[model samples]
Target: MNPLLAGDRDVVISAATASGKTEAAFLPICSRLAEEPAEGIGVLYISPLKALITDQHRRLESLCEHVGLQITPWHGDVPKSLKTKLRRRPRGILLITPESLESLLIHQMGWLKTAFAPLRYIVIDEFHAFIGSERGCQLLSLLTRLGFLLDKEVPRVALSATLGDLVMVGKCLRPAEAGCEPAVIESAALKSSLKIQLRGYLIPDRPHDEDDNPVDTVQNQIVADLFSILRGKSHLVFANSRRWTEYFAAELADRCAVHALPNEFFPHHGNLAKELREQLEARLLEGRLPTTAVCTMTLELGIDIGSVDSVAQVAAPHSVASLRQRLGRSGRRGEAAVLRLFIKEQEVTADSGAADRLRFHTMRCAALISLLLKKWYEPPLTGLNHFSTLVHQVLAVIGQYGGARADQLHRLLCARGPFQETEPAAFAALLRSMGEDELISQTHDGQLVLGVKGENLVGHYSFFSVFKTPEEYRLEAGGKVLGTVPVDGPLLVDQIIIFAGKRWRIESVDDEKKVITLTKAKGGSPPLFLGDPLLVHDRVRQEMFALFESGECPVYFDAVARDHFEEAVSGFREWELADRPWLVSGANLWVFPWLGDRVVNALAILVTEQGFQAGNDDGILEVRNCSEAAFKQAIKTHLAGPRLTKKDLAARLEGSPIEKYDKWVPKSLRQQSQSGHFFDLEGAYQWLERKTDFLR
Candidate 1:
């Protein structure tokens, strides 16, 4: 509070979840605002989620009630009546999301300076979520513009739980300030007791000796386990995907019915209706109903879902930082944080590879847990161009000013903002491409205006977001709208499918309405949700290799897991995987780089570019129709050659789009965007040089 009141340095408060970091930021900010009242918005609070902004609005309003401070939550959901009031007289702390802020910058440019001129502090909550993302770049650009508008340095405060490299985060928080020193309050040393358990299950090829059927048996066991372990306790069950969240929640509900128990489980994810999500959050927070939410990363943020007794992960931990944040949700009341991990794998068959036979999922899960305990997290990747976001900002700047000169647009976005990574020649090339694609048009006086296509794009509501979201088909059952799922094709009637945790048979498909009508079905498979696989970190992969070599049994493993562990170790030794990283399968040669996903992706692309049909599955690089000698030569050639540019590698990518505006970008620019954002060529090159020495 003293430092903030002094207002000499920016502050970043890093603490564990539920450790009062929000209050730590607001307490000082509100105190200073009280001492020196500002007519305009006092503090601009930005978060990644609208739900979080709304939640913080309630908390901050109460805290600032006596101070005669106004608190307003701004997002898509907020009624226009409330927004109109803000537009007329924006005062006090305004809680907003980045998308809404972008929209405001576009729609209300005339009032931005007036509404934010007296801004004293800017608070960015959940700061880690924005790091290394296009949204983060958008935010930095927005802040740069705001600073230029007000012509003053706003004392910034960032609140986060799982931030690594404070120096990098500080630089990102204030990119406009040269050599900006941030007062960092790190609480990594704050220790909490954690109780974690890893349970493993192997699905049989046929449900003969184990049960009547494999699927039903596994579902019943999972439900029974949930009932026995987490029943009547406020808990969160996190699945890796939305489809799984719905499937598990519905399965749990079905099991409760079979056992004559009340349905205490609910599904929460981004696909669900906002009202349904809010209802579930309200119930969880009220604590009257013993509820458990089978959710995705929606509830992973600091959105006050009340004290969770424990957190259960359905698969391998996404990342050490993610696992740490999820674990922080528990043990908030001074008890040991409880983490229960359930790893499922199919029974090893004659055709199973060494990775499958050795239960790689279990090994990976255990390795991630061990590393997280040791307090090692993945560092942020740097040197991204973020060209897609630059495109969006160009459109936004045009929309904001109605029209602007090309050089002026370049100065506002490229020359003076976070988009400085965009070279001048590249910026000119982008403008020309935009003009060619009818996304922008030039006026007679050499000004840039939104083209017809650009107007049509910026006219839509989704244009405010820089991330790409697929077109979704709404799902309805019993005349109730359950939620939406992204589908790329048509669905026939009477097709049985699983969605939102229940089995449903499609009754009708309204193509024009983009809705699917369904009736309850007895047996069905989970809906196929298309998404990229979770990328494992290099350190975690290395730790997995070490786990195999050490042969130490983790204490958290149950009886079955221990058996699986011993079997995996035996299989690993028999297969000589510990001594040999490469394996021969038929005519194809598989190499285990044992690196992170980005490096593996780069390796696959590089090998494929070199005329070998190469792919990656479960962290192994599979090269086809190539002898060991040719493969070694190819590797040597790549290592000895110059590094591939983003353009060169992107040309070999089969033209896959990575972001929303990527499709609108020129082919050359899109290639650069995809390569720069998604591929770590340098990392892969370095790993190839080191890991291939054994082959030579």
Candidate 2:
């Protein structure tokens, strides 16, 4: 082993997925443990997902036995007896999730020193997954607190497969003043010999009348075609949502039955029981049966499911980064990976014909694939302010320590966190807002503690996470509950809802606990497009503008996709869609300057800030009666300004609705907490810069 292992610098092992990144990270730590096996926990391994933690534990256990060290996994599912064993004889690595780590700090405050006294290194697996998220921010705060508690600098080692922005990840893991040196070990460039294939479909024409059955007819045809390709292959079919996963699974199975094929397929998503998910994973790994698992993003991560033969994506994956991860899952055994994209085509019979719709759909798929093939991945991080997460973390700190001084809390939060640049006045304003909200109570001794309301919040397991989840109503039938459906609005009696892969007719609703009783129904209802907001990086918008301007086509576009792209480009040039920001299509007017989602959001914010009535749906930013000249000027001015700093971008994200931690946190902390979420002002500026000339 290298003698430089005693150094205090962070190590980054950037290898491809399934390439022993886990072993590479753990080997050095285990080597140190061999030299000096500390009495207490010697290493901390943090993972983004609970499933990953469980998998890591098994892997670590075998290695620990080889090295004569004890390894333990501590998550919600881990038994209490195991935890007691660790507390009694703390040794080796302690695997945990961010929320579980927070629980330890909150519940086991007294054990902080003894348990972590021997801590030499903190290993964050899949560090890229945590970047630009509230969970990332929360983990950063926890790490900062742990550092403060240890009163010593801890070396952080981060392992990731696909990281588009390494600098951002470094900044997030270690602040500038911490004097931490990050070493990047990029092995992906060496190992990658990836081959990608893009598939295309034609949007079929439908009848002009409402009585036409082409929608279902077209869906059946698509499913049939997909089943033919999927059969006899051990593949993972990815759908964007759970309901779609179910629909596709059922459709594929039904198609199989009609074709007299064995019904060995399964559906795996978050809504399924843990047992079922594990069963599917085991079957896939065994490779005994010809089974295909239709799943959501649950299977997208680094969970080992053996080597999948191929991957079929249902629609356009939201971004190229996600597409790369999914595609990378296959082709691991020195063979080229195969990916088939099935785009569901729908035609607007009123004005836009099937050709136009198909061309547009084909263009989008081509654009995403082209971007990926050209080594460009979407870095569209969320732009919303995370002040709420900060609020929860502050409250969590006060709860853990019983009572903490105001200055200490502020300094600890802002000094080391991603919010290091946040001004004292803004932080004070947030604190005052929390004080006004009665979430924090100040004692006569001038210390801060959780108020009654805040105490109530921290009392629940749900308060541990900062991610926003809508208030959902549990769907039950004959005393056995199915799953949950979001309670966005009041549900009337007998309203049909589809959840957990089944359609249900509402029998009754208990509004108090937000539970809805239901019975099984025959026909499937339209799937709920749970308005998952998409962030568009300024880079993508600039690329889109480039796509419009450049005469040469992107090399990543496949032959069929390129033909469609050429058609779209021809149409855009003929209609002058690039120069004219407004084009009325069907019922809505599309304002196109080739900007991605973030700039569109900035434009929306600019409109809202400028006293103009505007709305957004899907990727379209809508405004009514606003002069074209004013919109052009706004774009030009924003483009001409100096690149937006992180703080300025975060400021733009202020005033977004608090999705998580229901009003218990102080407003100021909430704002500070939301800072780390993907509010890239520079990206926004770049996007606007590309569109300024077109706007004029």
Candidate 3:
């Protein structure tokens, strides 16, 4: 507090959820502003989600009122009247998202100097959410650009509950600010009991469609368990994706109807209408109803949802950090946190794939939970070039100043901003690519300005977001917006679909306007992907190896899970995985490098480049049309070949890091930037080197 309030250094406060992290950041900021009485926009408070800003508005409204300052929320959904009032005056604290801020930077560039003249501190809430993402890089660039309008360096304050590496976080917070390492403040860990259980279900190994209906005996059992335990409690049931969120909530609601009980379950996610999402949030916060919101990561962050009785995960969490965030939603107010994992595995038989035989899914869950219990989550993603974000920033800089020379653009974005990893030649190449794409053009006087295409892009409201927003068709029922779906293919009339936790019959499909009119549907649904999409860290897979090597059986495992794990352990020992990490059956050779997914994906591509068929099955590397001995010899021979570069590895990938601006970027430049973040060729090389038998 002393350093934050009195000094100019940046600060990062990491603490458990419901432990006053928000207050810790705002208390000092509010005090400093109230005491000094700054003129305009005293604090630049930023959040990752618009819902979070709305929640903060309610929480901080009274405090700002007491301190004789104004607090305003700004976003796309925000009322124009409030935005107009703020624009006219621009005083006190302004809560905004990265997109809206981008909007102001482009649309209202003229008013910013007057509005931000008195800004003192910049606060980023939920700092972990924006640390390593494309949005994170955009936020950093926006802040760096905002710095250009101010007279002095504005100290940044970060608040988070699930940060793994303080050093990495500090570097991200101040990428170009030398000697501006953030002062790390972590709360003392509280001693509490954790009651957890892991239950496993066996899915029948029958033929299934990729987009099949999410209804079966295994799913029903998991929902039945949820209905029995969480019927009359305020808790959060987290699914891996929105599709499963809808499926689980609808199933749980149907069960309540069957028993003549009040429907306490609801689905909450970003796709749902604002009114519907807010209603569920209010019900949970007020505690009037015993509501259990089955949701995606929408309800994962800290939003003052009151005391949750427990947290339930439908499948394996995408990452340890996400698991940590979801778990933090519970175990608050000095109560032991309760957790249940509904791990589902296909019944193992003779024809099971390598992933299922290795029981990779269940072992992944166990390893993640073990890592969480040990207070270790993944560190920030390393080696991100963010070429797409650079493209957005380039256009933004051009628009912010109306026109800028190429050298100035490069200096600000490449030299001084978060995209320092991009080389000068690469940056120059990007500018040329943008010109060819018609995103930007150079004037005769040596100034880069928006072209006709760039003008149309910067003119749209959607241009503010750096992440990819799929083209979605709105689902409307009786003139009310339900949700949206990204149907990549054509949709005909009289189609039955599931969305927003309910079944819907497609009444009409207007391709021109991109809207799907719907009516109340009686039954049936087509489920989407439910498996984890994030890459598994090397430490997690290594920890899974330790779990298999040791003979300790945790008490939290159910009988089914225990049997599944025991079988996996026996198979692991029989296969000699600890020593060899490879297995051969007939024509296939499976190599378990225990390397992270990024490296493994690169390895697959490199192996494919060597004229062999290789791909990643879960975390295992599978090579086709090769015996074990042949595969080993091939890898050794490749290691003795010419050294591979990121460019070479990236050239093989069809698509990587598909951000919004990636399509407009040149192929060579896109590959250069994508490779920095997506493919770890050096790691793949090192793994092959370690595994190759040099003595032979």
Candidate 4:
């Protein structure tokens, strides 16, 4: 327990969640700061979340006080006075977020070196979050620029409880320049005693002649089941969506009132007021209130709510890694963590037997819990080719410096930033597009300068994020805005809708202006399908396949879930599709490769490239009218190649809009980002190669 220090070299501390890794990381940095007591910022702690910054600040502040040092948390919520204080007297450690850091780099360009002159250590908390996101790429570019500005080799330390691929995570953080050796400190010895239980709710089969409503019955059953769990233990119930969180919270509250139990439990999501979220967090952590808060991904990271008895996931917690994080929240402090997974039964026709339905549910449960027990979390992958982010960052850089020469910009962007591999021609093409769009101008000094449009974009808060967000109209009812809704769809007046757990009717809509007004109503609204595509990792699919093949029942499965798995396996065996690459049963042909979204997409491209018509829905990939011979041939060709070129991969992602600015980016760059190769192309290729056996 010598703190697992990585010395002067860059390092990674990958350990289980709730492990002493956080302390292990900070102890060395704090010890170093205490010994030196630098006048300027000694350490820069970058977290993916604003909440994490606040959480770590409190923890570090106490340690700072113990070591007689200073720590400051700087983000949007941090008072301007505190930032001014830091500017005037920079010292110890500075906890900040990527967005805030981006703002600081832009607004305080003159003070970049002075503000961080003494900065030596850079710790990226939850390094896993940064790996596969545009934000991660943005952070890498920003760090490179900061290093260039300071003209120093800063040691970076990445801390994460879950990492599917440690080498890739390290590579993403490592400087491209040679001689910068980064060490990885992986402590797999830290394990959690988590008892995960997968429970399936059976939906009574409705005959074709009967007027049966599955939604109502399922909703009532879910409410009753949720109440029973709440009655037993203090728990955290996770819903995949904000709307569901609200709906479930209201339903549970109503059920609790009927049962004469205290209705102290509430809902916590992004749309809720900051005060309300903080209050819930305080109550959960203090354990003063025996409550089960329904939440979305907002609660997945950062905010600590002490130890709870159990975690109940309304549906598959999206991914095994996410399930692990949610389950890890419970069972802290030597207590066994309990996770109850409830899967809503989907309607099935006579053609679809109990085995088919059970197969889907059981496989999902097995895959999720298996990965969690194996301690394998998906490492972050690179996102959509972000030429837009590149263009935006370039403009931001120009705005800060007034103007930058072409060579200087190229060196800064390509040699140092995340776009290190981007060619000069591509950069030139981007500049031409920007010039066409009037976002940047070539000055008489032969340097790139931000145009008026570029200045406006940089000034806007929305530009801070590289992700695309739909232009949404604020849903207002009774003078309070519930949340934003996509403006792309048509809205009819007087239509009843469910949002934030309340029923409302659209009073009016200004189609041209993209605004909608609403009033309280009972019921009569169509369900809104917000296209929130789940990122299914490649490993999850493999685990799902394993679940189907393996006769062993997972420990997490309840009676219904166990039955479901058994039935699904039987169905696979009956159809002889368990080992088949693709199965054609009637109109629906299911391809069970068990690959993540990216690889599936790649396969889709591969199929299309081989002159086969294909489409995908949900988790299944379909090739229209494909013969078995053609399918086998395509798989063989794909496996025969050493690897697909970046160009070929980009070709597959053509017309796939992942980010907001993606639609506007040149086809080439968009392809690169959408290919999701920022982490490791080799791993993805290997995953594809391994799946070729499934074709048999």
Q: Can you give the TM-score per candidate against the true fold?
A: 0.87, 0.81, 0.90, 0.84
lDDT of 1 by residue, 606-696 (tens): 8866777565556667676677778888878876787676677767543334566765666666666656655668888787767676559
Model 4 per-residue lDDT tens digits across residues 475-559: 7766766777754222335434556645566787653454567887542222221233455677777787777777688766778
Which of the two candidates, 2 or 4, achieves a greater lDDT against the reference? Answer: 4
**TM-score winner:** 3
Q: Give a tens-digit lDDT track for model 2, residues 1-696.
A: 342266477777766677788887778779888888887888898998777887778767888999898888988889999999988877788999989999889988778678899898899988878876668878888998898888887888888777766655565678635555577666744224555555545455645453223344455666776777778879999988888899989988887788787886689998898889988888888888888999998888887787888888877666777777788778888887777776644433454432353254555565666677676665425334456567778888898898888788878887776556556776677677778777788999999888887788888898777786567767778998666766532233444455554456667767556677888755322211223444544455455556655646645455655666676678668767656655544433346535555455444544445554343332345544456666666556655665445555345432224357535444334433443432234544565555556665
Compute the lDDT for candidate 2: 0.67
lDDT of 1 at 647: 70
Clashing pairs in 4: 132-381, 383-673, 384-673, 384-674, 385-673, 385-674, 468-660, 496-525, 538-596
Cα lDDT over the full model 3: 0.80
Lowest summed lDDT over 10 consecutive residues: which window, candidate 3? 523-532
lDDT of candidates 1 onward, in order: 0.78, 0.67, 0.80, 0.69
Residue 457 displacement (Å), model 2: 2.1
Candidate 2: which stretches are off by over 4 Å?
A: 1-4, 176-179, 190-195, 202-217, 348-361, 378-384, 472-530, 544-563, 577-590, 605-658, 665-696
Ranking by TM-score: 3, 1, 4, 2
Q: How close is candidate 4 to the true structure, as a TM-score?
A: 0.84
Best by lDDT: 3
The CA root-mean-square deviation of candidate 3, after full C-alpha superposition on the true structure, stands at 7.4
